[model samples]
Target: MTAFGISAFGAYVPRLRLDRAIIADAHRWAMPGLRSAAKGSRAFANWDEDAITMAVEAARDALADRDLSKVAALRLASTSLPFADLQNAAIVARAIDAPHQIASSDVAGSQRAGTSALLQALKGTQAELVIGSDHPSAKPASVQELTF
Candidate 1:
């Protein structure tokens, strides 16, 4: 049988960008060699923008050319889920007006959770929509946080 393919894809980078100078100044003491290039810019989530909103934007783009009713399942992968216990995938499904019976769930914790969710969706029987996003934090002067 033929395997599934991506119908569409979308990415949303927040409008606000924190200058490298500010970051470098704040972390100059902590990170000796923290330069602008070393510490790339950061995207700031707007007041109303959360994981759910970002996921909705991505899902909307992914469903652009497809029928919402055809989406039977939605898998959301995120390490920065706004709510600890709530199902963010359901919120994304509702936002996109997907079928009422569509299966929805969240995969979180590790960065690898994205791959896990994708693998699970691909192995499943239903037509699936998988969305992954991350907003990981690091120490103020940590290189990992600055690079991303």
Candidate 2:
């Protein structure tokens, strides 16, 4: 199904980028190991940029200048979904103005979630919108601070 490929793409990154050296400098004293991963900058989500919101931004980009009527599903893959009880894919589908009948699901927990969702969708006939978004957070001065 080579013809069954992506026709459009969209993306969004936060305007705020955190230099990795800032993390290395601030925490190297306690966690010197961080220096190894502190060369590039990382996109730091703003207070308003949650996984759902970012996914919607991407959906907006992907759906722009295209016909979404053929889309049968919205698959959201993430390590950190915003709501524990709510379906994030549904939230994104709604944000994109997808038909209420559109299928929605979450591929989460594992690093291969996106691949898994794509493999599954490839078995179907209709186009599927797969989105990957993350907003990992940590407490101040913690290992996660440097890691994230």
Candidate 3:
């Protein structure tokens, strides 16, 4: 039987970080509960960075010192995709200069979007590049803002 498995992997976290304390302090006056969760910081993307850009960087990191021509498929997962109607994965593939013949797609909608894509890739019979990236949108002073 043929074998399919992950040979390499890479991840990218933005340089900017938003301290949970900052988030808590902003809302603690109204929601003192936030103070309990304000221990660590979360990655904050820059104005120029988005799901697509981060995915590209991670893919590049994984593909570093390797041949891009061998990549057979690309899958990008996120809850904060820049475009709702565009094929985001194609953009990522193009950004990485991945070959034109490879398959590419975007996955989103559910919180498990990334996990689902990863599971599918692992079960499939082709060499796939799966990336899970998110920049969730949360309302100010809301629980999501402090936790997400």
lDDT leader:
3
Give the CA lDDT, 0 to 100, for residue 103 in model 3. 96
The segments of candidate 3 whose C-alpha lies over 4 angstroms from its true place after superposition are 1-3
Tell me how candidate 2 scores on lDDT.
0.84
**Would you list the C-alpha lDDT of every candidate in the order shown?**
0.80, 0.84, 0.87
TM-score of each: 0.86, 0.85, 0.89
In candidate 2, which residue pairs clash? none
Clashing pairs in 1: none
Q: Order the candidates by TM-score, highest first.
A: 3, 1, 2
Question: Which has the higher lDDT value, candidate number 2 or candidate number 3?
Answer: 3
Residue 72 error, candidate 1, Å = 0.7
| TM-score leader | 3
Score candidate 3 by TM-score against the native: 0.89
* Candidate 3, 1-148: lDDT as tens digits: 7666778989899998898999999887899888888888887789999899999999899888988777788999999899988999999989988899989989999889999899989988778899888877788877788676
